[model samples]
Structure formats: C-alpha cells, structure tokens
Target: MSSAIDSKHDATHVDHAADPEKIHEQRGHQPGIFTDKDLMTNAFEAENREHEMTLWAAVKDHPMACFWAFVFCFTIVMESFDMFLNGNFVALTAFKERYGVPVAGGSKAIPTKWQSALFQSGQCGAFVGVFLAGPITNRLGYRWTTLLGLVLMNATIFISFFAQSLKVLVIGQAFEGVPWGLFIANSPAYASEVVPLVLRGACTATLQMSWSIGGIIVAAATYGYNKRTDEWAWRGPLALQWVFPLPLMVLIFFAPESPWWLVRRGRTEQALRSIKRLGRRSGNQASAEDTLAMIERTVKIETQTGGEPTLLDLVKGTDLRRTIITCLMYASQNFAGNLIANQATFFFEQAGMSTDFSFKLNLINSCLQLVANVLAWPLSGWFGRRTIFLGGLVVNITLLFILGICASITQSTATNYAQACLGVIISFVFAGTLGPISYSIIAETSSIRLRALSTGVGRAAYYVAEIPMIYLASQMLNPFGWNMAGKCGYVWGGTAVVCFVSAYFGLPELKDRSYRELDILFHRKVSARKFKSTVIDVAENE
Candidate 1:
C-alpha cells in the first residue's frame, strides 16, 4: 500500500516553478484530489480577510487545543524565565559574592571560569535534554514525557534553593536545565501536532508572550529581592521556578496525548479520540476520524518512501536542507544581534544607569516584549514569515553596526544613555518580528515524524558559537574587565550580516501552509522563491 502510494505521488506531482504555463492553465478549476474544504486549512485562513477573527474562532472552537497550547507554551516561559534569571542574577551583589571571586578592593566582584560556566550549565543540560527528547517522547509519549521532565525540573529547583555550597548550587542549576530543555524541545512539537493548521503559528509563537511574561515576573522579583546581600534574592527566584510546572503537570495529566503520535503508533482509535478532543467535537468523531486517517495515511506512505524517522535523516538530502534552515533559524534568533535582549540589565548598568533604574528599565523592556509578542499574533498573518524574519535581520544589521561604534565612544555618559535607549528600541523591533516567529518556523520546517527531532537539533542549546560569544560578552561587559559596554554589538553585528545573507537566499514563506502541503513542497525540493506561489494537492495519495 505504502509503495504504491509513493509511486503514484511521484508520478502525479508537478512543479509549478519549472512548468508555469501548465499550472497557469489549470489555475481556475479545483484539482480532483483536494475536494475537502477543511483539509485546505491554509486556504481558508489566507482567503479570509478576518484572520484575527479566525484565530479567535479556532480557540473558541477547540478550547482544549487552546488549553494544551497554553500548557506547552509555559515550558517556553520556563526557558525564558530561567534565561533572564541567570542573566540578571549575574549582576546581583548577593549572587556574585556567593558564587564569584573578589577583585577591585572587594567593593565589586567578577565570576571565575567555574562561576561563568555554572550559569551556562543549564544550556549544557538543555543540549543533552533536547537530544534525548526524541527517544523519550517516542517511548513515553507527550504527556508522560513532559510530566517526567517537569518532575525532574521541580526537584532540581528545590535542590538549588537548599544548596549551601557553590558546587551544590552549580550542579543543581545544570541538572535543572536538563528537564526544562526536555520540556521546551518537546513542547513546540506537541503543540504543532495537536493544534489545527490554521492556528499552528499563533499557538507556537504564544511562547514569546509567555516568555516575556516570565521575564517580567523575574525582573520584578529579582529587583525586589536584590536590595540586600541575602540568599533570598536568588533563592526566591529559584524556588519560584516551581510555580509554573506544578500546575502544568496537573493540566497535562488531564490533556489528551498528541493524535499524530498516536497515529504513528497504530492506535488509530486513540488517535481519533485525541483529535476529537482537540477539535472540540469529542461526541462526533466523524471529522476527527478523517484527520486521524489522514495522519495514518501519511505515516504509511512515508514509511515506504523512507523509513521510521531518525535523527540521521535530518542530515540527509531534503531533510538535511530543512535541518540546516532550522538550525540556522534557531541560530538566527541569537546571532541576529539581539545581545541586548539577552543582557539588557547589564547593558543598562554598564551605561551608568543605577541598579534600581536598570531593573526599572528592564521591566519596561520586558513589558514591551510581551506586548510586541501579542502584536506579532496579528502580524504573523498580515505578513509572511520571510518578510518579518528578514526585516528584523536587516534592521538589526544596521543597528548593531551603529551601536558598536557608539560603544567605542562611551567616554560620554550622555552617549551611553542615548545608546541604552537605542538598544531598547532595537529589542522591541526584534521581539515584534523574528523572536516569536522562530519557534514556529523551526517546528513547521520538518515533517510530522521528525518534528520533535528537528526541533531538538535546532534547539541544541550549547553550541560552539555561544562559548566564545559568552566568554567575550562576559569580558566586554564585566565592570572590572574590558568594559566595552554597549560596544559589544560590533561582534554580534558581524554575525547578523552572515545570518542575513543566508536567510535572504534560503528562508521560505511558510506562513499559511498545511503540514501536508509543506511536506509536498519539501518533497519536490522547491526553491525558497517558489514557496508562496507553488500549488500542492496534498490529498493526491489519499
């Protein structure tokens, strides 16, 4: 069955880019295979003027899908919260004394290699955890896999709170990262599976809002607690990490597993139930059965064409191209010169802003980021992903280059203040554009079976670029060290230029395509330029 389906698909498939006249001739009439209106989810979404209303309709229509999306998105929030907490804590007087060696008359402190790397241990753990997400999710399924990760996460945070020694604390932070890494890498793939295609981008990008929310919460808490040199300043936030996952664990226990995963496992009935629940029509599995059968069909066809999904597939042929784009997609998030977004508080302080003022500024920046993420929801429909992704990159390339030059002239306190404001503005534009969209891009780039695996590879947290970037970023910003302050943007500016060139030639407009259509496009090996105009009859083999 599978071999026949693949053979038939290869025979009938057409590349509109290659033979435009033929596709142009057939543009008016509906193809025989794509008869079902619901299956063309992206068409309904794009043709309608009210995509914003469509987003609400999707949530109202599938409240459980919304629930699972929100739950999955919090793992993203956990990642954001942990990142900000680590970034902010490094600037704290209490945390520094506890974890660092004294330098300049004991009035200020700088972290040793051990302390510097300890903050990064979570990223290291995240790399390992993301790599493990594929097998863990494959064996245990989404719910248990997520629950187990959360359990480990909760335990590690507890360990961080009670630690009396630096060894204990660093070890705990590293271990704590493992589970949330597992959680984040798996969460986006889960949301992509459960949500209808119409709402996939919005659901996946909701992570940015949750991420901003967590950062705001951390900034506020860290500001309040860091007044005196006490353990509560850091420990309070450490303990607060548990607040997100505990309730999430309860919620996942009640949520159905991903229907796509169920289909691949040959549990079609369970898959139907899952789809019905997500579709908000549990009493009527008619539509649910259709979607489940579609998944099963795709799996069967793919099994014949290739084999069971593997990480190795990500580095071969068409999959390798996707893996590169996704890897660079994730890299683009960091390398696109938003270092200010990562270390906003430090940048503020290094610019002569007082600690309280820095925290206040950080709070405002985070609020802007949250609002921007929310605004991005509507814009994600109004503009193609390639447009926003490149727009942000182009703007940042210019901003980072200018900002780096400004860093070189930081002799003037006034100049530092002005650039600090500029950095905030740059961050806002970034959040409003590429920051939220990257999660969706990476998840949507791969086929269903490899979604989790590809996302894992894309999110391999502790990569080579980061080691030098972190070390140099630390050296440049440390008050007692090189203190390049705002000038560090020069380094990131170069990387942003590289990212921009690759994205210009390679990034496709994947804004409003159904998963099946996307798979077909990749299967044909269409160039990025053809994506917006390409026509795919996803139901051909069905």
Candidate 2:
C-alpha cells in the first residue's frame, strides 16, 4: 500500500517491525547475512537494537506521502457513502412506498424479503472480490488493479443510480462489491509500502478515516432527502457515489506503482524511479538506492527458498497463527457488536428517533468516527496498538453490557433515549479503536511474501462472518421478522466479550517491531505481553 513512498521501507515498503504499520514492515539482518529461514532466527541475535527512522523523522519527512495516502484512502469513500446510504434508505418513508410489503391491517409498510436480499447482495459480491484481490494484486500490480475496481464500481453505481427494480438494484450492489473487496483487502497493503515505518499508524488510519468521511457525507445526504416523495429521494443519493470515484480514476492512473510490487516483478529500474519520486515528494532522507537495495535483497532472499508462496503457506507453520489471528480480528468486529453499526438506521428507528433525525445522528456518528481516526495516529503510536485495542474491547464490553441490560429492562421514551445515547457511546469506542486498529493488526502480522494472499484470505474471513450476521440482523431488526430491538445487544455483547478474551491472549504487540522481527516472535511463540519490551536486532545493512 505504499503509494507515495513507493515501497520506501523494507522489501514490502511497509514497516517490518510493527511500529504500527504492520502491512509492509520487514525485520532486517544487515542485508544478505542470513538465509531466508534465518531471517527470523538471526533477528533475535541482538537485543534492544533500533532499526529504521524515528517517529519524528517519519512524520516531519512526508508531505507528498500524506497527499498520496489521502488519495489511497479516498478510494473507499464512494463505497462507504454508498453502503451507509443503502442501509438508511430502508428507513425512508418513500422507501416503504417503493419496496415495502403491505400488512394485513392498515399498518405502515414493512420491508420485504427482496430488500434483505439487496442488502446481502453486495456482501456476496464483496466476498468474492476480497478473495480475488490476492491473485489480481500479485499479477497486475496494486495501482492498475485498484483502477480496474474503480471503473467497475462506477459502472455498477450507474446501474444502481437509475435502477428500476429490486432485482436491478441488487445486481448493481453486488457488482459494486467486487471493487470494494479489492480496496478493503489490498488498500492497507498498498499504503504500507509507501510510507516510512514511523508514519505507518497515521497513514493506515486513513483507511478507516476514508470510510467515515464517506459515511458522514452520505448520512448527511440521507438526512436531506429521505423525506422526499419522488425518485429523487433515492436516485439523488446513488448519484453522489460518482463524485468520489471520478477523480480517483484519473489520479490512480498517474500514481506511482508500488515499488515492492515492481521489485517483485523484476522491474528494478522502474522500482528505483518510483522510490525516487516518493522520496523527493515526501522529503525523505533515505536514498532511492538504499530503499531499493533492501527491497531487491529481501525479495531475492524470500524467492530463493520459498519459490513463490501459495495460499497453503498462509495456514502452515508460523503464518497459521498470523492467519488465524488476523481472520479472527476481522471477524471480531461484527462479533464485538459492529452489527449495531451496520443496521444503525433500524437501531435508531427502534430507539424512537424519526428516520430523518436518525440519519442526522448517523452523520454525527460518522463525525465522531472521523475524529477517532484522527486521534488514532498519535494514540496507536504512543500507547501501542495492543493497549488501545484492549482498551476499546473493554469499552465495548462495558457499554454493550449496559445497553443489553437497559434493553432487557424496559421500553419507553426515556429508555429509548438512553439506548440511543449508549449506542452513540459504543459507536465511538468501536469505530475509533477496533475498526481502524484491525488494519494495523492484519497488515503488521503478515509476512511480506504472503502479505497480499494472507490479507485476502483474512478478508474472506470477514465476509464469512458477515453472512450469518446479515441474516441475524434481518431477523432481529426487521419489522417483518423478530423485531428484537435492544435485546439484540445481549447477543453481540457476549461476542464482544469473547473477542476481548481472544485478543488479550492471542493478539501480540507488534507495535514497533519489523515483519522479520514479528516472524521470530511468533515462531518462538512469545507471550503477547512480552512483545513490546522484547528487543531484537533489525540491522538495515546486509
């Protein structure tokens, strides 16, 4: 994901040692001194050895890096905007007129089965798309694959914008999922490649920030138009998806290819030039040759023995833990009560807010998420990734337990207000920490060699988790179904507690360690608590 810095650090262009950029970081051993297998063993030969740039050095260096990172992150805004709007549209009065089923008596229209299918269709596409990212990204390179996704998304949005029936809209949404799957699975990897290890936390945080920005804009749009009677109510919002993707189509074409990808493909000259461009733009102190030298050597060493890894390798030996943890981390988001966010409109409607005000509350909710992402940079770096994530888990457990209790006790105007406020609190806690920080965990944990495939596989786990939850959310929240409002909190509250336990035990602290260093730590099966203080050598020279 290192777009601007062009694979600036380690071979993968991400921080090898976790300094919070986990996607591209690589632990080093003074160049070619160790065999690929020894990449981990020799890393532990020394202790308390600092490798790479200081945080100040990373932040103060990259102006252009920031620009490119924003470009990379903005890729998801259209997707986020579309998704948020899609959910809230069901809450609209006009939406009922268009898609709702009639009740036996003279009651308000209820959401039909087709609408549930429409909501799940995108996930269906996303599931396939995320799994496809590994092969495509590895074969075509990150920039082009991303551009192809944008083109596909735009075409699908065009179909959805003027959709005439639920079938058409469902088809469009499903097609739209393909591109987003690529973005979610690969965007962090691309960002990691371009930024210095020091800036990894802030840059990767942009991935989460982008989603909130789109959600905020779309939520605001929903507030403005959900009350309208004509087709403009829905059509108008779908058109807004176009706004974010247009500039990206052109901008991505011109953006530098990831040097890590280029180097892997044997395009040494192009990789060097890309690195040079990023360094010049970002005001980086490291030379293109220095960065490219590490990249070339690292790729060469990994290739020499591994002979190009397959998906099977992700589940074998050291990477199995990485794969399992990363997958569980993505799965944990929903299990840990992110389902509340996915169906926020219905949750708000149940909590006594009008559809319009609920949408506005969603807008506010997105703003809080945005602010949380902004704060994640400093907090994820200073306090360490595990600490902040564990804190978020605790917050989730407490807030959700309180909500679960409240929902079980009563249903009234005052209670409704309390439930809504608590939902807001939980949104802040979950979105700020778990949602954004998980990218760091997935990216930082994987080895550079398997980063693309493993991340894709992990995203596959996300879709797997999403499928049942979609049905559960429908059954629990829909008027046509169970309609268990606050009581549903109890279901996911238990899941959050499970995630908190898993993370405390299984998720290690890779905060400032290189990927190579992480390899050693995981292989040695180091205790999660010991990772932060367990110093090891990461010599940049070979």
Candidate with maximal TM-score = 2
Q: Tens digit of lDDT per residue, candidate 1, span 421-529? A: 8788778878888887887888789777787788888888334455456666777788656777777778778888898889889989886666666776887889998
Q: How does model 1 score by TM-score? A: 0.87
Writing each residue's lDDT as its tens digit, candidate 2 over 1-542 gives 22222222233232234332221235433433444432332222211212345566655555556567668778877667777777777787787687777765554554646656766788789889988999898898888888888888878887788789878988899889998898887788877777766666677778888888887887788788887988888888888888877788899888888887898888989997787766655434345555666566556545643667688888887778889988998888778777777668778887778777788788788788889888887777676678878899888888888887887775788888888888888877877888888888888888777888888889889888877787887778777877777777788788888888899988888766655467667767788888765654344322
* Count of steric clashes across candidates, in order: 0, 27
What is candidate 2's CA lDDT for residue 397? 84
Residue pairs in candidate 1 whose N, alpha carbon or C atoms collide under 3 angstroms: none
| lDDT scores in order | 0.74, 0.74
Query: How much is the lDDT of residue 256 in candidate 2?
Result: 83
Model 2 segments beyond 4 Å from truth?
Answer: 1-52, 103-112, 281-286, 539-542
Model 1 residue 56 CA deviation in Å: 3.9
